[model samples]
Target: MNQSRVTDFILTGFPGLHQEYYGLVSFVLFLVYFVTVVANVTVFFLFATNRSLHKPMYYIILNVSACDLLFSTTTLPKIISRYWFQSGRISFNGCFVQMYFVHYLGSVNSFIFLLMALDRYCAICHPLRYTTIIKKCTIHILSVTAWIVGIGAPLALVIRAYPLPYCGSNVINHCFCDHIGITVLACTDRSPYSFTAFVGAMLTLLGPLAFIVFSYGSIFVEISKVADPKSCVKSLSTCSTQLIIISLYYVPRCFVYLASQVGITFSAGLRIVIIMLYSLVPPMINPLIYCLRAKDIRQCLIKQFYITTGRQKAQVFAVSN
Candidate 1:
C-alpha cells in the first residue's frame, strides 16, 4: 500500500455538465448564497433589535437561521469558486475542516429543528406549562447543547478517518469535502470507516428526525382533543410552516440514503445535483418560510420597514424646512 499522503484533493464537480454551463450555475448558486445570507441576517438583526420577538420560539428560530447562515457560508463559497474560477483544489487539512463543519453544522441544524419541534410541542401540547418548561435559561442551555453535540459528534467521525492515508486518488467526486467522499479515497480497506460513517449519519439524522416526528405527532393528537375548530386550526397554522421546512430538510436526505443503501445507482452528476438541491434549497428558503408564515416575524418586519421609511421621511422634511 502506498504510504504517500495526498496533499490536496481536486473536486470532480459536475461530471457531464459542459463548461458552457459553469458560468450560469455559478451565477445561480451565488444568487442563492446571497439570498440565504441576507435572509438569515435579517432575522438575526430583527431578533436582536426587537425585544418583543424575544420569546423562546423566536429565539430557537433565530438559532436555526444562524445555523443556516453558517452552513451556507462554510460550504457554498468553495463550490461557487469551483465553478466560477475552475479552482477545485483543497488541501487535505482544509478538506477535513470543511468535512467537519459540513457535518457539524448539519447536525446542529437537525438538533435545532428538533428543539423547535419540542418548543412547538410544549407551546401547543402543554400550553399550561409551556412558559415554565421552556424558559429563557432553558433555551440558552438547549442552544449550547446543540452546538456542543454537533461539534463533538462530527469531530469523532473525522478523527476516526484522520489516520487513514489518502494515497489512492486526489479527486473527490462531490463538490465539497464530505465524510463518505473523503473516506472512499483511503488507501486501506474502507469498510470499517464506511460503516462507522453510515451508522453515524443515521444516528445524527434519524435520531433528531424521530423526535421531531413524535413531537409533531403528539401535537396533532393534542390538537384533536381541542373542541373548538377555530382554536385547532390556529394551532395547526402555527406548526404548518415548520412542518414544511422539516419535510424539505429530511425527506430528500432519507431518499438519498435509502437509494444508496438499496443499491439503486445514480449517475455521479445526477447524485451530486440532487444532493445540492436538498442541501442548498433548505437554507435558501428556511428564513423566507418562517418570516412569511410566522405571524410574529412578519409583524416585526413590517414594523421595521415602516420605522425606516418614517425616519427617511422625517429627514427629508427637516432638510426641506
Candidate 2:
C-alpha cells in the first residue's frame, strides 16, 4: 500500500459506463449543463432586473437561482471535462475547494428552501401580518444568516479532512469531491471525519426538512379554515409550486441517502447516476417550473420578448423609410 501525501485525485466519474459510450454520455451531459446554465441565469437576470419581482418571495427565488447556478458550475464543469476532454485529475487543494463549494452551496439551497417555506407559511397562515413579519430588513437578515451558516458548516468538515494523511489511493470514486469521496482516500482512522460528516449531512438535510414539514403542515391547517372553496383553492395554489420544487429537490436525495444507509446495494455507476439525477435535474427543472407554473414570471418573460421583437421591427421599418 503506497502511503504518501496524495497530491492529485483521478476521478472515476462513471465507473460502470463503458468507454464506447463516453462520447454519447459526454454529449448528453454537455446539453444538460448548457440548459442548466442558461435556464438558471435567465431566471436570475429576471429577478435582478425586474422591479416587480422585488419582493420577499421572489427574493428567496433569486437566492435559489444563484445557489443553483453556483452549484452546477462548481460540480458539472469538472465532470464534463472528465468525460469530454479526458481531464479528471484535480489537485489536492483544488479538491478541497471544490468539496467546500459543493457542500456549502447545497446547504445554502436547503436553507433557502426552508426560508421559502416560512415565506409561504406567513403568506397563507398569517396573511394579515405577512408583510409585517417578513419585511425587507428581516429578509436581508435572514438571507445573510442563511449564507453564513451554509458556508460555515462545511468549513469545519474541510479543516478536519485537511490534516489527515492521504497516502492511500489517489483515485476518487465519484465525479466530484464530496466529504465521503475525499475522506475515504485518507489512510488514517476516518471514523471521526465520517461521524462529523454524517452529523453535518443530517443537519443539512433533515434540519431544514423538519422545518419545511412543520411550515407546510401549519399552512394546510390554515387553508382548511377558509369557508369559500375558491378561496381555499387559490391559497393552496400559491404553495403547489413550492411543494413540487421541494419534492424534486429533497425526495431523491433522501432516497439515495436512506438506500445507502440500509445497505441497499447499488452499483458504483448506478449510484453516480442517481446522485447526478438529483443534482442536475433540480437546476434544470427549477427554472422551467417557475417559468411554466408561476404566472407572473412567465408573463414578464413573454412581455419582455414581445417588447424586444416590436423594437426590432420598428428599427427595420425606420431603416426602410
Candidate 3:
C-alpha cells in the first residue's frame, strides 16, 4: 500500500473469482438486483402515474428509490461484469466518477431519511398543518439540496485531504472504489487526512441519526396524546420502520469506518459483503416494508392494478361485441 500510487483499482470484482463460487454469487446478486429494480420501479410508477400518491411520504419514497437505483447501478454492473467476464479494470477517472456518484448519492440517501423523519414528525404532531407545510415545492427543494450537499461536501473534503499522491499497485479488494480503501492507496501517511475524513463521515452519519432519534422521540410523546385507536397504531408502525432502516444503514457503516480507522483487518469476502449490505439488503426490502406498513401506497398499488385489469377487460369485451 504505497502513498504515491495512482492508476485505478484493478478489481477482480466477483466474476473472476473461484469458478464454482462465481455462479452462486452471480445468481444471488442478479436475483437481488432484479428484485430491487422491479420493486423500486413499481414504487416510482405508482407515485408518478397515480395522482393520489402525491403525498410527502411517497415523495421521500420516490427520492429514496432514485437513490437506491443509482446506488445499485453504481455497484451491481461492476460486480456482474467482474464475475462473468473477468473485466474489472477501471480507469482513474472512472473510479473517481463512480466514487463521486456513490458517495454523493449515498450521502443523499442518509439525508433523505432525515427528511423523512421530519415529514413523519410533522404529519404526526401537526396533523392540521401537514398538508400545507410539506408541499410539493418543499420536497423538491429539499431533495435537490440533499444531492448537492452530499456530493459537494465530500468533494471539498477529498480535495483538501488527498494531496494527489501516487503509490504502487491498484488492486481494490471489493468491486467498488470504497472510501477508505482508495484513501489507503495514497503515498502520504493517511492518518491526518483519514482522521479528517473519518470525522466528516461521522458528522454526515450523526446529523441524520440525531434528527431521526429526536424526531421520533418527540413523535412518541405526541402520539401518546392522540386518542384515535387506528391513528396511534399507524404512527407507531411508521416510526418503527424508520428506526429499522436507520439501524440497517448506520450499523455496518459505523463498523466499516471504525474498524478501518483502528486497523482491524477484515477478510476480503466478508468486508465486501458488509459494505454491499448497505447497498444491497435494505434496498431489496424497502418496498416490502413500505408496502406492508403504508396503507396509502398499498391502496394506490391495488387500485392501479385493478384499473389496468379493468381496462384490459373492457378492451376485450368491446372487440368481441
Candidate 4:
C-alpha cells in the first residue's frame, strides 16, 4: 500500500473553538506561562542565593521547580502562538522532541513528589535518623536517578511512535504533542503502541503515587501519637501544603488518562480544559503554595527586599547630595 507520509502536524488548541475567542484564549495562556516562569525562576533564584536553604527538602524543591519550569516552557509557548498568531503547525521531528520533554518532565515530577513524601515521612517518623538517612549525597544520587529514568522511559514511547506510518491525518487534537495524541494519527495498527503507552503511563503515575500514599499514611499515624496539640498542628500544617500540591498534580491527570483509556466519552474542549488545568496550574502556584509560605524562604525574601530598598534610597540620597 502506497501512502504519503505527513511531514508536519497541526496542533488544534481547542477543537470547535471560535475564531473570536482566540485572542482571549491566547492572552490567558500567555498569563499562565508568564506566571509559571516568574514563580519557578524566583524559586531558582532563592535556592541559589540562600545558603541556609541548602538542605535535603529544599534540594528536592529545587528539582521540582526546575522540572516545572521546563515542562511549562516546553508546552505553553507553541499553544499560545497557535491561538494568538494562527500558527499551529509543527515539524514532525520537532513535535516528537516536544512530546519527549512533556512526558519526561511529568515523570520527573512524579518522582520528585515521591522524594518529598519520603522526606516528610522520615522527618516525622524517624526524627533521630532523618538527617543521616536523607543526606545531600543521597538526594543528589536519587535526583540524578530520577532524571535518568524519566528521560529513558519516554524515549521508548517516542521511538516506537515516530517510525509509525503517519499517512492519514496530520491534526493533533490536543494542544501539545503527546504519546496518545500523536500515535492515534498513525495509519497503522496502534493497539500495540497504545498498550505500551498505557502501561508506561500507569507505571509512571501510579508507582510514585503508591509510595506517596504509604509515606503519608505513616506520617499521619506518627502525628496522631504526638501528645502536644501544638506539635500535632505544626506537623499537619507542614504536610498540608505538600498534600495540596500533590493532589493538584496527580488527581486530574489520573482522571484524564484513565478516562481516555476506559473509552469514557467527553468533548475535546472539556478534555483540553482539564489537561490545561492540571498541567499549568500546579507549576504556576507551586512557589506560592510551598516556597513563599516557608519560614526560611519568607525571611530570605524579606531580607533581600529590605536590602534592595535601602540601596535604592541610598542611591537617591547620593544623587541629591
Which one wins on lDDT?
Answer: 4
- For model 4, what is the C-alpha lDDT against the true structure? 0.91
- What C-alpha lDDT, on a 0 to 100 scale, does residue 162 get in candidate 4? 90
Clashing pairs in 2: 4-167
**Higher-lDDT candidate of 1 and 3:** 1
lDDT of 2 by residue, 174-232 (tens): 98999989998888789988999989989999999999999999999988988999999
- Ranked by lDDT, the better of candidates 1 and 2 is 1
Candidate 3 C-alpha lDDT tens digits along 1-321: 324456667876642367878767777888888999999999998887878888777888888889888788887888777766767788887777776677777789899999889898888888799889988899999988888788766786557534557576677766787566666666667787767776767677888888888988899999988899898887788766666766788788877877977999878777777777776888888888777767788888888889999999999999999
Error of 2 at 107 (Å): 0.8
- Candidate 2 residue runs with Cα over 4 Å from true position: 319-321
Using lDDT, rank the candidates from best to worst: 4, 1, 2, 3
The CA lDDT of each predicted structure is 0.90, 0.89, 0.79, 0.91
Query: Ten-residue segment with the worst summed lDDT in candidate 2?
Result: 1-10
Q: Per-residue lDDT for 140-228 in model 4, tens only?
A: 99999999889877999998999999999999999999998999999889999988987888899999999999999999999999999
Q: Candidate 1 on 1-321: residue-level lDDT in tens?
A: 446888999987787779999999899989999999998899999898999998888888888888889889988999899999999899889999999999999999899889889989999988899889999889989999999988877998899988897887999999899998999899889898878887878888999999998999999999999999999999999999889888999999999988987999998899999999998889989888988899999999999999999999999999999
Judge candidate 3 at residue 104 and give its lDDT.
77
Lowest summed lDDT window (length 10), candidate 3: 1-10
For all candidates, the clash counts are: 0, 1, 9, 0
